[model samples]
Target: MTRQNVSIVLIVVLGALLLAVPALAAALGNPALVGLATRVLIYAIAAASLNLVLGYGGMVSFGHAAFLGVGGYVVGILFHHFRFSEPLFGVIAGSDQLLVVLPAAVLITGILAAGIGALALRTSGVQFIMITLAFAQMLYFFFIALKTYGGDDGLVIRRRSALFDLDMRDDRTFFYVVLGFAVTFFAIYATVIRSRFGLLLGAIRQNESRVAAVGIAPYRYKLAAFVISGMGAGLAGALLANYQRFVSPDMLHWTKSGELMMMVILGGAGTLFGPLFGAAALISLETYLTQWTERWMLILGPVLILIVLFMRGGIAGLIDQLLRRLK
Candidate 1:
């Protein structure tokens, strides 16, 4: 089969498997399987968001997890006030409805991203990374200081966000709901990559001076992409908070940001579907390894190192190579 045909077959097979997950888990009597799959979808969305700036825009943000934390906290804090029938800041009312909550998370993160990008984008290379990381650390500590919202112990959401008639409490239902969002995001990202803006972003990554010489300011485009990427991370954060029913300062930590970066790099930084593959591979590896040994990170470290050392473009690249060889 040709490459296109092979890719198509692979996608269809992958989709089929995803659709069968809940049934398979039920048959195997392992409901945690659904949860694992749900987590992967959430991470995939977050990792894809990071790819927009990291992969296409050639930006390295060490503090991307701040967006995730912010998004989750938005949901958590809003609901906490709602449960008490108290308005947040004695102004905005808390909402349990998914429609209200998710959009709020996205909008808040977008604003945060815009402010951060406006300043961070002024520098280049390591300075930019450090500035982003600093912003993340600041947010992380800020959350930790919010003693009213469980502080270091974190906050538990008693219930999931309501979405009209949908029963999100059901594992299968929530998984499908998350799947719908993941698929929607993947479609949107794909569309973005095909648009003119995506083309310019790629050009900036390849050659910034040349693009600027042509009278296009790379800053505006980069900032725009950064804001959009943050919004995507925010959306994923909201979904993740809904799935886990908890939010904590750790969500905004540097380590969590590192994890998201690893997902993007491991899956093939610049490729579509790379983040999904990366999230699945990393999460699956962690899941299986932890089941076997407590020191899973020791094993994971070397494995990731080997892949980074030998694999040219990560898992997606490896697959492309195999397909070409088969052809």
Candidate 2:
């Protein structure tokens, strides 16, 4: 078979395995395994969103996790107020419905990203990174001081958001819900990266001056990409909050942004499926390694460094080279 055919087959097989995870875990009576798989999918979504800017648009944002936290807080805050029969901002009523909460999360995060990107895109390189980080830290502190939603203690959810009467409390059902969203996000990411907009964003990444010389506005394109990326991360955060039934200030911490970037790089920055692979690899390593020792990060640190030094493009890149050699 040709290399392309082989890859298609491999992807099909991988999809089948991922789809079977919840069932397999259920059969083995391992809820934790199911939960872990769900977490991986959620993180994959977040990393893929980050990849849109970091990998393709050449925007190094260290505050991407701010969206994640924002999304989670949207759900948490809404639910908290709903539980207490309170109205948000004395205008909008709280909701426990996924339909309402999810879109709100995405919308709010997208707006926040647009505002931040407007300013951050004016600068380049380290300045862009620092500005993004500063914005994210400011959001983090704001959440911590909100006190109404448990503040530093975080918010606890007593029930999952209503999903048209689906039994979201069941682990298997929740896994499927998360998996569906992950697939949808991947589809959207693929479409975005292949579209004309994606091409322009990529060209800007390669040479903003050249793109601008052609009458294209690089700032506008980059800002749109940034907003879309934030929306994706926000959706993932909402799913994560639903999955864990909790939201905390830590979700917006700078380190979480680092983790999302690490996943994108570890998988293969520009590749479509890179974030998924990266999340699986990193999370699996953490899960298995921690069982052996508490210093799993020490081992993971070296592994990441070695991959950067030797792998060049990461796992996806390594696989591509092997396929090329075989062809």
Candidate 3:
């Protein structure tokens, strides 16, 4: 099929799914599950952001979760210290004020990404990965040591940030906000992947030496991709803090970073929508499996191994292969 055809089909399918969400929620009669799905969508955005670096830029960052933690903590800390009642510089610091917090989270994450990428882009292969991981660990411990906002125990957001009186505390309202951001980020990512800079980054990923030989600086492109990825993760992190009404150092753990990478790989790296599918599938399976049995990880481990062993291209790649075979 042509790319246009695929795009149309995807748009149609996504529209249908979104339209059906309300009906589905009504049928299930469980607001909590709907809320859970919304959370998955937020993570999908984060995973897609990571894919910009890992899949396209050929930069393997083992500390992507730190961005999310940073975003969440920004929301938590600001509200806790700055008095959740009034706006800072005319903007509120609560969960309902997603507009205010989201940009702040993204900017902060971008700043950190720029600094970390400057050092990390100087290295390559396993060294780059280890350096990123170490930086994340350092931040994790810093948060742990912060005794002001519940520190190791985490801080609870007593109220949702305000957005023109829309109560974000309502599960349905929050779900729609997350869904909106997910779709918006997906569109932005698609545009970025097709832009000139994206093409250069793609080239660097395939052959850094050749890109450098052509007079293009591979490091700059990689750093740009890293900052973009960090911003995406930060957006998800801010939303997550609102969803959970808390922030903790655990969000910055290496395991969380690994999970982001796993989502990218499982969803078919380089595919725009792969991360969304992967996050939804993995998180859903985890949620259901944990409820079914105590040894959830035991079951999950084999499934992941099987996917790596047999489904080499992941779900999106598998779909592509099957479609080609049909043709």
Off by over 4 Å in 2: 27-29
Model 1 Cα lDDT, one tens digit per residue, 1-327: 777788889989988999999999999999999999999999999999999999988999998999999999999999999999999889999999999999999999999999999999999799999999999999999999999999998899999999889999998999999988888898899999889999999999999999999999999999999999999999999999999999999999999999999999899998888899999999999999999999999988887789778886878898988888887
Over the stretch 1-327, how does candidate 3's per-residue lDDT look in tens digits?
Answer: 775687689778976886567568888786567776887888899999999999888889999999999988988877774564554456653434667777888899999999988998899999999999999999999999988667899988777666677777788887777888888898889999999988898999899999999998788889989999999999899888888888999999999998898898899888888898889888888788988998998988888889888887677898788667766
- Which residue pairs does candidate 2 place in steric collision? none
Name the lDDT value of residue 158 in candidate 1.
90
CA lDDT scores, all candidates in order: 0.94, 0.92, 0.85
Give TM-scores for every candidate, taking all chains together and pairing residue i with residue i: 0.97, 0.97, 0.94
In every candidate, how many clashes are there? 0, 0, 7
Q: How does model 3 score by TM-score? A: 0.94
The segments of candidate 1 whose C-alpha lies over 4 angstroms from its true place after superposition are none
Instruction: Choose the strongest candidate by TM-score.
Output: 1
Locate the minimum summed-lDDT window of 10 residues in model 1.
307-316
